[model samples]
Target chain A: MGFLEALNYPIYVAIFICVYSFLAIGLNVQWGYAGLFNAGVAGFFAVGAYTSAILTSPDVPGRLGGFGLPFIAGVAGAMLLSALVALPIGKICLRFRGDYLAIVTIGVAEAIRIFARSEEWITGSSRGIQNLPRPFGDLPYVYSQLAYLALVAAILLVVYLLVERQSASPWGRMMRAIRDNEVAAMAMGKDVPFRRLQAFVFGAALMGLGGALYAHLGRSITPEAIDPMIASFLIWIMVILGGSGNNRGVLAGVTIVWIIWTASEFVTDQLPMEYALQAKYGRIFLIGLMLQLVLRFRPNGIFPEFRPTQKDSRKPDKSDKA
Target chain B: MLDFINFYVVPGIVTGSIYAFAAIGITLVFSIMRHAHLAHGDMATMGAYIALAASTMLGLPVYFALLLAIPLTAALAVGTDKLFYEHLRKKPKILTTMSTLGTALMLRSIVQVVWGVGTTSYAKGITRPNDWFGLKIKTNELITLLALAVVVLGLAAFLNRTRWGKAMRAMSDNRDLALLCGIDNARVITLTWLIVGGLCAISGFFLGINTEIKSMMGWNIILPAFAGAILGGIGRIEGALVGGLMIGLVEELSVLFIPTEYKAVSAFAILLLVLLVRPRGLFNGKII
Candidate 1:
């Protein structure tokens, strides 16, 4: 393969890494910053992908949309619709403990998958939405790929900066406080449930945005693309492995995991046809085993949450003497 | 009326019995471990497949295959606890819950790799329902109900009559108090997993017998089973049974009013309604 040929694969992989970064960062906001377990990452992703596809694609006679709106509108609409969907779910499940939230989210994701599969008018009933516009469609294949990669990376950068800033602010501290000790936070007059809902909805919006990016890149939105194994659990492993609270750590995690996942597929394809299919499952088993190893050895992740020492108001500071 | 009973109600009861088996195991894990065992469904799937192997490979009868599956599945459950969940016992319960999700994925992938993902069943030919006066009931359906009854009664007797069972209950009620009372928490946990695992195997085995066993079958039923567990009041075994039956019936009956594809929605709807209206569940089980 020529230099450009090799570059094409890297660009493609990099674009996916950028998209997955959004999911990991979104999950980090929920699970890392706020200690909310939102397991339905795929659900939000599907909503976003479908919304964008419906908005941007040319009019289809039988289906719901084909409004032919601009790409920006579709992306924004994706975020809005995803947040709207998360609102009630977070409101209901957030009142309970994290485990309840996790189960509810899983169900919600499955329900969304069913809807995407069966609701022919809305989601095209497994055929999915095709002929969606790509931003640099007129460009050569390699250039378009590069452009998309740059675009997603830029968006990821912006999201990372904003999230980092938020995590550093007092609101972030309050969220951490609520997460670490709900009763204590409540005692200190933090609106625990409402704050949780805020984090959950916010994180869901990012996931939706990620989905929109993915849909537009692929120039189609399909139910299969939103499988829990890839869209949800993969993001989860990324977040948990990267160090949930650290934005940079999660990005690093995204890069590491996506490489392993994609690289393994290539390696498995080299195997005999019969064994290849089994190798695919073996890869998944490896991912699952990786999570167990991470949980057992480095529960806090690669870069643990940065904890600034709090000065006690009741006593004189000892740091000055040191 | 007979058609309704045969088509919806009878099938509902059979499936409900299956759900009850899974839900009971979930409730046991939830109450005893203070975390959702997210792998519970996949564990059931594993059990069902094991029974299939026993019957197909070992040439055992289906019931005898189930008997073999029960102890093996119980051991698998306890083994997972020892290998994956033991150290996390002192950590946050949510960590263990997250780990179980990974375990779920692992278990499902194992099933897919071993069984090759295509659907399979114990027996090849379909058994026609036996006519009883006006009512039609399959022999397997009858067997399912009988099995459910036996399991429930046996579990009730064990929980009420045995010291170890009482210790398990005490731990569920209050871990610190149970510990202070010199109850061996480890033994109680192991005993709980043994019961839960056996229940999982039975549920999976029956679900496969009634329907077909696919890799995704247990994952699909997991939502309804959870709905049943939550509706019945999380920690109550009887609540799980009732909830499971209700969910199964409602799901079956929903096909009459909505597209058959949307039957799963009934469980999701019920789960939301229960969570909104009765977070403590119908039997006043612990929310924690």
Candidate 2:
């Protein structure tokens, strides 16, 4: 019995790791490559979750949704809606530096939360949209979970390959160049704001896809499904701690942080009845403390950005002398 | 007309005063430290908690608790800056803002662990508003407005006339020039945090007095405070004050046309409009 439970536990953790890896990869594009600070990961995630939930879930009376669309269409809808939300926000704030983007994204996230909570016609108010379709629903519990896990892993692999290829392409180099030196990129005649917007919308779509996957896994979407402060901030920590520009580092970071987070949660759950709530909050406090420590001690994270080799560095060139 | 003043204008001014007070701290930090103090609202929650501790544990009056909270919160604010933010001063200012978001979560979690996630008031029981010249106002609301007026006036005088305030302004104007002119950068930063902490306490205390205190109150107020700061101009104190009041009025008046649940949308709309139309703000604040 204990062996069965242990096997199930790691499987659950693995599923979550896959979901969070998608978010961290999305953030890697925005922050690592494009130098955009998106504080509203939860917002895009919610949009995706809701879009998929509304599309796939059967009709509930008095609600605006219940399209009964196919699962693929739902996922696509999630990504498309998330990008649609990102477009206006990126257009308005991408013209400025990252500071404005940070605050505006936060505000936009709050606005989305407000709309979800208040717009009962769409979000079903406090009761939330339910009965979302799950893949492999007819199988045994463990097998169903395993099947969903495999599906998510396959999606993560595809996203990972696509992002990796993009990062190696000329567009990725131009993004990094713009991030490092906007004036130099501008002198080269690149439109900085437009490129940043593309990355922003693209990254948001990935986050939305992550959300859709999570919604389908849970078979529900609610205002409380994603805690903006905790869920969104956790993804930020993953990307930052993993080494922002390195995709492998992001995957590693997600696994480590998720383990630590869940391990702490397990310990807190073991506490006596009265202290459980306090312990839960204490765990939150520690997550925050960890962020500060990592920022101070390992600002470049475990795996710093990898630079390509240049053969001519053994001798001083004319430009060096000048 | 009387009903309008009693219902909307009075409450608007009271709420606006709270925003103005908080925005002052935000603007001061932005101007002097060159970063958005994203933890500003959570710090206010800390102050309110400190005051709650003072009142409950020591049996101090609510106003006295506010006074006690100022110095304590200032010390804490200074400590956080030295530990978390001071090192980041050499980095891009925006990174400091990011760290402050972490700080906000940390501060709020600390509050939650200690106080739990329940609402409480400084002094219990309802107090009915008094009528004067056909205008109804709560005594706390009256005191809030008066205190705001005095603080704003005193702050303006200090900025324009006092030596330390002038030094702060000099730093805000140009950090390198201020250092070259022999102003103490460390002293100015500490002083700014001190004032910011105190103002944060005042605003938090007033908010607690007017409404119940809760762990999430600070988070809820942050966007409005940011809206006010941006509306008035980021670095300009007077602009922040005016902008805060305007936001307060607009938020209250918005209830007339829209659902009360959508009140925050108005503040966000204001923020976007300001960002798009006049990023420098109404007072033509420093572009930086």
Candidate 3:
């Protein structure tokens, strides 16, 4: 491949990174900052993707089609739809901690997948929906690619800015308190459940946004495309490798993981037939290797360890009274 | 009367029994370790593949093949706990739950690696039909159902009568007290893996015999298994048994009114409803 074509691969991979990094930031906000591990990011991701596809697909009438809204509208719809779903999911999930929440989220994602498969009216079922509308129809493929990239990048930047500002805010501080010590936070009247739900719902919305972008890029949507293994684990890996609580670390993690993922895709093509077939099994091996290494050596992750601030750490054990 | 007895009730119980097999392992792992073992499906998958290899390659009788798989799968589970989970004991519970996902991925890859990426079927001779009261049961299915009953009885006896079982129960109720009382956490954890792996292997074998052996086969019904365990209450082994059978029956019988494609609907629906309305599970965490 020539230079631009070679550049094509990295850029395509970067597209996934930029979108994924947005999600990692949200997850960092939830699990890294507030300690809510959500294994159902895939569900929200699918919700967002399908939302945009259904709204913008040429085939679908009424409901959401024909307005010819900008890509931004689809992005907004994705976030809103996903967040809407997450509200109820969050309600149920926020009540449980530890494994209960983990399994419940996985169940929710699978349930969504099953519904998506069963309800052919909403999603196109196993056949999937195709020909998703791009942001600028008049533009060429390369410009469209670049425009879409720019669009996602712009959204990522906006989210990063907003989340950054929030993290620096009082709400962020209280979220950390709740995560570090739920009982103490509850005693202090921090609205522990509400805060947890907010973090989870918000993070899930970002997952939706990423999914919408991914659907546009691939130009097709299918239940087969929605594998929870890759969708959930890869994001966790990114958030961890990047430093769960740190946005910058998450950005780095997404970039590195996506690159590694892309490179593996290329490198496997060069391997012998059997080895190639072995490597073809979806991104599980790479994701596992990263988690194993991260857990073994750098449990805190590649960025810095997320530590409670001195102010928060010094707070009294008010929860003990309860 | 015949429809209720022949069509509805018996089928529900049979499928529910299959689900119970899965629930047993899931409940044990969750109760003892306090994390949802996402790798449970893959362990079942691995076991099914092992049994497939044994029965087909070695020319062993399928019954002996299944018997061989139970111990082999249990050993794998113990090794998995020692390697991955033991270290995770000190970490936060949710993190470990996410970590089991990594283990799940790793295990599936290993399954795909050892047994190529295709489906394997039990030999026809072994899977042939056997008449039991004119019910037209497959020899494989009946053997699986009976094995499940025997295993359930065996496990109940072990838990009620043995030191390890009592310790496991105490640990599930309160880990801190169990630890303080000089209960060996390591042994209970190891034994937890042992039971989970054993039943998971049996679940996998019958699944292969009833359907087919594929990497994702165990996971396909995982939600139902989750339904079974949680419905039975997390720590209660008997709850898992009943829960699984109930879930299986519901799933199988739903096909009468709905498309077979929507079969997994019961598992997720029951799971979501139970989680929402009865957060403690159907049995309300009732220890049997």
Which tens-of-lDDT digit does each residue in B1-288 have in candidate 1?
Answer: 989998999988888899999999999999999999889989999999999999999999999999999999999999999999999999889999999998888999999898988998999998999999979988998999999899888887888789988888899899999999999999899989999899989999999999999998888888999999999998888899899999999999999999999999889999999999998788898897
Model 2 residue runs over 4 Å out of place are A1-6, A309-322
How accurate locally, in lDDT, is each candidate?
A: 0.92, 0.89, 0.80
Model 2 clashing residue pairs (backbone): none
- Cα lDDT of model 2 by residue, A52-110, tens digit: 99999999999977799988999999999999999999998888877778888888888
Give lDDT tens digits, candidate 3, residues B1-288: 655656676667766777788888888878778888888888899898888889888999877898999999999999878877778788877666776777778878878877777876876545445556756566556677788889889988988899988999899889999999999988888988888888888888888777778889877767788889988898777788888888888887788888877777667777778878886776777321
TM-score quality measure for candidate 2: 0.96
Top candidate when judged by DockQ against the true structure: 1
The DockQ figures for the candidates are 0.76, 0.67, 0.49
DockQ of 1: 0.76
- Model 3, position A315: C-alpha lDDT score: 62
User: Which candidate number maximizes lDDT?
Assistant: 1
Native-referenced Cα lDDT, model 2:
0.89
Ordered list by TM-score, greatest first? 1, 2, 3
Candidate 2 DockQ category?
Answer: medium
